[model samples]
Target: MGIFIRILGAFVLLSATYNPTRWNFTRWAEANWGTQMPLTLLFGLLLGVGYLIYIGATLRSIGAFGIVLVAAIVGALVWVLIDYQILTLQNPSVNLWLGIIAL
Candidate 1:
């Protein structure tokens, strides 16, 4: 159950970070604030901090190695799903890979 929650959390985090139709900060900034490097940096920092917090909490509950193992499983699952067209992505980029690894 704990591991399941972790997996679900990882999926949610990845979606929030990478899904353009969802909570994609980069897309939002580009549309509203224009394509500026400073805004990109700011959004990146915010996302990075959020990722750290989420990872820290997961690590606290699962330990370092366990977290890594979980991340690997989640990443592989995501990659396979995307590759097989189980998950539809309009423009999958490095962020998708990073999000999977971060999960």
Candidate 2:
């Protein structure tokens, strides 16, 4: 449950920032910039806080090297899938989602 919660949180943070669905903070802020600057800034700051907390804990837990190691492993697995024709980089949206999930 704990692990699941952490994963969920990371997903939320990433999704909130930018996702394949094309609805996220950047778009929201851009659309409302002229009319809702305050609200947009508020949400942007909140999202920044979320990123700080997540990134701080992540670095403290694993450090940069660990992060790279994990990424390399995942990249390798992704490469294998591509080799096996399970994943294709031809679709940019899929690649973007994979990159987001990988992060």
Candidate 3:
């Protein structure tokens, strides 16, 4: 349960910050900057803090080498999925799938 929650949190944070859709924080901030500067800054800082916490925990748990290894594994998995016709690179949702796999 804890692991699932952590993954969910990371996914939410990542997608909320920047995604293919225009409903994310970056898009929101860009569209409302002039009228909502203060709120924008506040949310930006909050997001920054959330990133710091997650990044710190990830580094502390796995270190840089582990991160690289994990990335390599993920890359290989994606390749295998493509090779096996399980995942199609041309699909629009592949981006979202990749993002989810990152968690």
Candidate 4:
């Protein structure tokens, strides 16, 4: 169940990336069908909330140190992938700057 929630959350996060409309209700509704907008928002929110809850539960089962280790590993993997251009460096310097700020 926890694994399922994490996968669902990842999917939602990916979808949200494509639909910048999520942050703007009027633009979203105008661009997409009203029914679709509501459904998308509901699913995205549910996935996001479920993912965080499940990750917290799973991390608790592991331990605090495990969470830190996992985060570091994932961060390193993202950096490597981006550096290698295996993952499109969308905004290039801007993205690197943003990443620095995020840390």
Question: What's the lDDT for all of these models?
Answer: 0.71, 0.89, 0.88, 0.61
Query: Candidate 4 on 14-91: residue-level lDDT in tens?
Result: 444343334543345456766597776775576668657757776778788887887798789888877888767565
As for TM-score, the candidate ahead, 1 or 3, is 3
Which residue pairs show collisions in model 1?
none
Q: Candidate 4, after superposition: displacement of residue 97 in Å?
A: 19
What's the distance in Å from true for residue 92, model 4? 9.6
How do the predictions measure up, each by TM-score? 0.46, 0.83, 0.82, 0.42
Q: What local lDDT score does residue 103 receive in model 4, on the 0 to 100 scale?
A: 29
> Would you list the rank order by lDDT, best first?
2, 3, 1, 4
Best by TM-score: 2
lDDT of 3 by residue, 1-103 (tens): 9999998899999889987888899999999999999999999999999999999999999999999999899889878887898877677666675756576
Candidate 4, overall lDDT?
0.61
Model 2 off-target regions past 4 Å? none
Alpha carbon deviation, residue 32, candidate 4 (Å): 16
**Candidate 4: where is the Cα deviation over 4 Å?**
9-52, 91-103
Q: Candidate 1: which stretches are off by over 4 Å?
A: 1-13, 20-23, 26-34, 69-103
